[model samples]
Target chain A: MNAIEFHSLSKFYGKHRGIEGIDFSVSKGEVFGFIGPNGAGKSTAIRTLLGLLHPSSGSASILGHDVVKEGVQARLKVGYLPSEVDFYPEMTSRELLEYHAGLYGIEKGEKRIEELAQYFELALDRPIDDLSYGNKKKCAIIQAVLHEPEVLILDEPTGGLDPFMQNRFFELLESLNKKGVTVFFSSHILSEIQRMCDRAAVIREGKITAIEDISSLLSKQMKKVRLVLKKETKLSLPDGFQNHHSTGSKHNFDYVGPTEVLIRWLAEQDLVDVVLTEPDLESIFMNYYQR
Target chain B: MSMNRTLYFKELKRNRKNTLIWTSIVVAFTFLILSIYPSFSQMGDQMTELMSSLPEEYARALGMDEGTWSSIIGFYSTYYGIYITLLMGIFTASTGATIVGKEERDGTAEFLLTRPMTRSTIVTTKFLALGTLLAVVYSTQTFFAVLGMNVFGDDVLWRHFVTMHVHGFVLVSFFTAAAVLFSSFLSPKLNYMGPVVGMIFGSFFLDAIAKATEQVSWLGYISPYHYLQLQAESGSLEVNWGSCIVLMILSLIMLKAGHARYLKRDIVG
Candidate 1:
């Protein structure tokens, strides 16, 4: 059985759609990514599986247990890191972790907690209210992994982490995956998802637009090309290039063809300066939506 | 340890300050009000004359029964006891209203509900924790009220003292359960002061209106205060099993229905 499965799972907040007909599955030991922009229902899908939001129709399950019917059992081996990690501010990190450890029925989690804290450079002794956003995020990371759950579900988990901590967190997740832990990572950041996931699902307007292996998805990566013409010249675009918009002497468009072909074309054109950058997830996502 | 026990302790720790503050307010109020009993009792005939001069309906509405003013337990029950019940009702109602909504308001609902626990279990544990906190507050207030009367008023009836606390608990439980019921449906902003204050004071005024206007005397039956007042007039601490059972059953119904709604709620935060 899959580690996580959603069968036509949908949630509606009154008349407003939270997530509609969200269907996906993550196999055991796979780091599956969920990519969507804000209000695109990434958090809604994650929260439904976690039993924080009840589905308006259909169902979901984790570890072969129904999320709604046997929610406690479904969550028995799961760890969740919410997008907004707000904790009891008055309590020290140690106190809050101890409280969570008790909830997960973890006896003697201090050693594991301390190890994660050290990895993330978390100040575990300070009160959580006094911690910076980054420090609080580190604390969130530590608490989530201390129990070493069989499945990890993170919604925008790396938002407040520094580059170093983000790398360390990825390494930790990789190790955990190696130990057969399944992960469901949700974020609007496409590159992060590409960097971490084996497979990814792109959602928009509460609907799944695409689900593909990371390698194939990366091949479809769109590069935004901006060229400054040395002289006033009318340039004709190629068949594979799309979203070509020219302003004055500068031209910007998304290129999906081979880099060698683009480089050859650029060499032939009278170009003063040229810069090729990766288009953000929004533009890429918009292309998918239009398709 | 189980999730419910862990959550219960966490909730208790969170409510520790609130419990202390509310309990102190009720206890202090009880002490302050009962201290006036000494002066009133000493006036004797002058007090009776003073009472007769006041408008009868106005005085009764203020909980001053002319005949009961001379007796220590009677005066304490009519004056301080009624207000103690009101304060306890507010305390319990606020506690019930905020306990669940606050989690959602502060974005901690995701943290707590995502644990390996069912929504039912979470609600049950929180309800138990709130019940435990109110129990502590009520018991402390009772202890202080009894002690205050002994110190200040003198000649206090132990039965009335004990009965008043019992009655206060039942009345507060009804309001608290109602608040929990409301909290499940309303957002945090609406749940806090509005429903609780409205229900407690609304029912209170209804009871007062029923007493003042003969035609609406049936209105008293709709308010928990009327039942409390009825039992308070009976003059014995031997549990008024009728009202106690009714209030307990109604509270249980509210709690069960509330839990069902809470289980199905899609937490916005």
Candidate 2:
């Protein structure tokens, strides 16, 4: 079953447009990455899916429950990390988690809170205001996952974290997905999405232009193969190899053929160091957004 | 019910500093005003002679014609009722404005709204938190006011204090509801000043119209401050139970409307 489904969802604030006709679905246990620029309706779409915002002219559902009509019920199975996580500054991490846990009727929430604290390497007793940005992000992450929610929706979850912490967060998300929890997250960082997301939807200007598997997306777009010749020798490349430019001893080719064809062509060339560069998610993301 | 209680307590915990500061100021102000009452009463004879020379309309405007000053109720009605009501209204407006709107200002609304709770629950919980704060402040002030008044050789009856406090309590709730209603509809940046200005100006206009013409006296019924008049008649100062009930119902209705709008409104990123 799809964990989330948006159908022609549109939202506008007075005369300004927010999102228009956003439609997508994340299947259960799938890591679906939502990619877009800052104002490409990414947050708006997530908010609408979470039932935090109402669509102006369409519908959304989670687990087959209508978001607008049965929001509370649908939200029960979901855990969310907002892009900007803000909580009561006076409360300690423990107190904040306990308060949230109380809403969900979690028993012995202190134990869960302690476990989360230990896992995230956060001090439960410290006030939220005193924590650093990365610690605060960890606190939010712990709170989001403590309930063991079936569906986790995170927006820019790793934005403030360092590279080490980002890797840890990805591991945590992977473990959660392994436990049959569906993960739906949005991020502008294409490389992170390429690594973490099984499938993704690229949105540009409030519209989803493409939704496809990560591997397929990279393969479909052209990859760059740069060959540095041992001796400046010219070789004839295949027909589809556009932009074959060379300077000094290095030859750059915008290779748009199969990996096997490129490998065979490189093997037939003179002694040289060849670098095969698969199209990164960043360039593909830019392709959608810039258009 | 549990969710509402949890959220209420959370709001209280979150707003402890602001609440404590406001409550302290209110208590200190009450003490200051009550301490100076004796000095004012010493000049009552001169003031009364001056009032007698003035026109009846002027005396009525100054609330001097209701010349029953022997009792605590009479003194409170003539001296501090209007002033306290205005103070309470301002406090109530500030509290209500911060309740729901503070979430937006602090960027916590998106996080809170994503929780597994209905928007009505959130609204009601915040409203309850504001009510709790008002009850605590008003009760504390009434306790101190009555104690202060008792030191002046007047028999401070429990019934009078209860009635006066009840009147203040209702108005606080009314103002809070009005502010929350506005907060839900307006931008967070304008939350504090907008509702306060509205309450002050709205009450002023309503009071002016009500006092200007007898035909429009019914308009007073629309103002929460009008129903909060605790010293209308001596020995017959009955609480307006009907209006009180109506005000409570209106507050709930307003809260419901806010919840409905917030639940449907798209949160701007």
Instruction: Give the root-mean-square deviation of each candidate in angstroms.
Output: 3.7, 3.8
Judging by lDDT against the true structure, name the best candidate.
1
- Given the true complex, what DockQ would model 2 score? 0.69
All candidates: TM-score? 0.89, 0.86
lDDT (tens digit, per residue) of candidate 2 on B1-269: 32366777788887777767777777677777667667656777775566467765444433344344545556665444566656767777787877777777787787788888888788768777877777777777777777777775366555755676677677777777777777777877674865586676577457546755567778777766676655534345667788788888987787667666665555564
**lDDT tens string, model 1, B88-186?**
888889999888888888888888888888777888889999899889988888788778777877667777666766777888899999999988888
Q: Tens digit of lDDT per residue, candidate 1, span A1-291?
A: 999999999999889999999888999999999987679898889888988888999999999999988998888889888788899888999989988999889989898888878888887899999999989888888878878889999989998998998999999999999999999999877778878899988888999999888776556667889999988677888767887888888898889878788888999998899998866555666567666
TM-score of chain A of each: 0.84, 0.88
Steric collisions counted per model: 0, 0
**Where does model 2 sit among the CAPRI classes?**
medium
The 0-to-1 C-alpha lDDT of every candidate, in the order given, reads 0.83, 0.77
Interface RMSD of 2: 1.3
CA error at residue B75 for candidate 2, angstroms: 2.2
Error of 2 at A233 (Å): 11
